[model samples]
Target: MSEHRQLPAAPPLPDPPPRPKKRQPTQDEITKARLKFLKEMSKHYITNEENIVAKEMFRLHKYNWPQILVVTAGCEGESDFVTFSSDEVLRVDREFNYQCVLARDRVGRIISIPLDFDIKCRVVSHDKASEKQFIANIIESHSLPVTVKFAVPDNHIFDLGESAHRADSFGCMALLKVYDETYLISNPLIDGVLDPHIIIIPLYLEMLISTVVGAEAMSVKEWEEYTEEVKKDAAKLDFSSVKGRKAMAIYPDIPDEAQDTDIYSYIRPDSYVILREKETGRIPKERINYCEIYKCDKDENVYEEITPSVPPRAPQKKPCSSKSAGPPIPKRDKSSTSTKLPPARSDVSDLTVAELGEKLKLLKLDKYVKKFEKEGIDGSILVEMDQLILKKEFHFKEFEAIKLTKFVQSGHIPS
Candidate 1:
């Protein structure tokens, strides 16, 4: 008869390393964390004023970097004030590549962790480039044809509202279009008054706030209902949140239908609605005092109290490659008689983030490709990218698929 005696209980596992207490983030810490985010965005694109912000960010992130070298407009009123409204502040510099919005990912990985992606301008590369020298060179050497990518169908970039500002959502909003100079008029009437008939005024929603006719008084219950309706309508997106505008851009409407193609499918109605200070227009700086960041890597998840200092700086690039001639650019295959090479593989599961980005760029699948980059050095992101590219929503560049497959097999990725 088999005795059903349980073996002695295994020795209790060793206690885990003590977790450091969570603390507030300092102003300096916030700036550095933001700078790291900006640097990541720079890899995909370069926009105006981005250099200046980068310089300022670099200064704050490092103690040794002298403040004298990095300068800004000295006076508050005279200068741009470096508000959320800075112009040409940064550009992504890639074709069909643009910034996507922030939202909680399926892995419980929200952009807010480790740093409030809200204020830091959390941008990442979204698409592949076309007609570039490097891409051309790769195709030429491999006897592969350079294939055109699927262009993101241009939806009319939505207009920005007068109330729209970075502070409204802690700079987490998706970018809308520029409205300053474009909307400005040269009437030369800044200090002068003119005939009301000649004003050419159009009906505007903001005008209602000043209108007596629309301001009819209502009962208390009616007021509550009215306020609720306003809140509801405010959420029904006036635009497709893009790379640069300020709308807290976190709560992007990624409906089930869009679930297949949209990269920001993680955001939903119930996601924690923080940083969205609807009452005050901007998140108070004091909130940084309570900020705590949880950074996870393959080895461990590090939670740090930020007010005193920030988490360790992002991993430095491999030092050995610092001065190496760097990876060789594959030579063009001039021997091939065919003008077109081959297409990227339909199966992208085996590719790394860098490699998958190349495939997306070849096919022009930037946003979906970039959604992974936003996840930061995660292998899981690679899997997510693979599933996305296979869907019908992505327009694959079949012409370049096989060529890309061979090129990737040849082992060369731009450093």
Candidate 2:
């Protein structure tokens, strides 16, 4: 038995070479991939006579072929496919899942091209800290470098150093200005927790374009031009409809005679306005019986009121019933006739500090009345203060501040 000199243990295998880091695809490579995908897709779906038209469109829009690809990537053709007539050169459909642009040749043979793209988002932030945290969370959660834009509501004090001119209600419209996308992210916070997600962009523009242009099919150039025009129109302030029409104030305490006027119209008592005339100057002195109505604008300043053309009417009195003569009527003093009437239900701007405390008692918020008095927050100041001011300066809790702010903003305190 050759004492086999134990063969020296085979040299330990060297550790496998560290795998090379996968190189990220560049923009050019990504675009190429997308184009290749779209070309293969066209070849698979398009056939016979329609295939010729598809190839021509691809050739004609070679510089912007990506646009065509996005517009017709995931489409399935069927007789039941919903079609919308465009004035330009293409017909479109409303179904987001099956969204497509249809092109027709002289004989009216139809080719459907699907439009699909990654949905990007624009977030509205009230402050820089919140915006930073929001973006950080989105990046961490998705593990992708998602492109995000930030918008601050008109008059919002964003610490991010960017001035935003867009209103919160039009945030979606601002997002639409970016034409290269499909879906939108909305309601970032769910149940008081930040949870951002995507929502389909409504085919509202397509429908509007179809209605306005009334075309059977639109050329690519025409489609782009019309889409841009529609987007611009959607973003503007439209006051033409209500310009000369009579408008009603949202507040109930406004005198019935003064409530409806041809000056300003609001959608809600607290925040929204439907139509407003540009301020010219102070209300004319000739309008004797005028009440100043304050409105918050995008600039954070209040709008001056326009005097109602109608004169304020004297309060009507109820006639006493002869059947119910309860007590012997006492002679009334004549001098009291000149006394001023009590303030309207919504008018508390004339109340004293102590009177304001009494008003708070009605809302079960009297605990903070002392704080208000201590801060010299009188009726005039109190009416102008918002929740942020109350919470920051008066040290009120979130709910407490919100309740009080709403009470003041509504301009109506409970009896």
Give per-residue CA lDDT, model 2, range 1-415, as digits (tens): 6676666778889999999999999999996875564334323221122222232433333343112111222221110011222222231111112322222212222212122212222443342222422333444454332333434322221110011112222222111111111211111112111222212222212222111222224455754564464344333533222111111112223334763321111211211122211122112222101012222212212222222331222221211100111232233354432212223235667678988888788865766888878877777777666654665667664335544655665654545
The lDDT of model 2 is 0.32
Alpha carbon lDDT at 82, candidate 2: 14
Give a tens-digit lDDT track for model 1, residues 231-317. 343344332222221222223344556543223322221112223232322223432111111111111111111121112222222
CA lDDT of each prediction against the hidden true structure: 0.27, 0.32
TM-score of every model? 0.15, 0.18
Highest TM-score against the true fold, candidate: 2
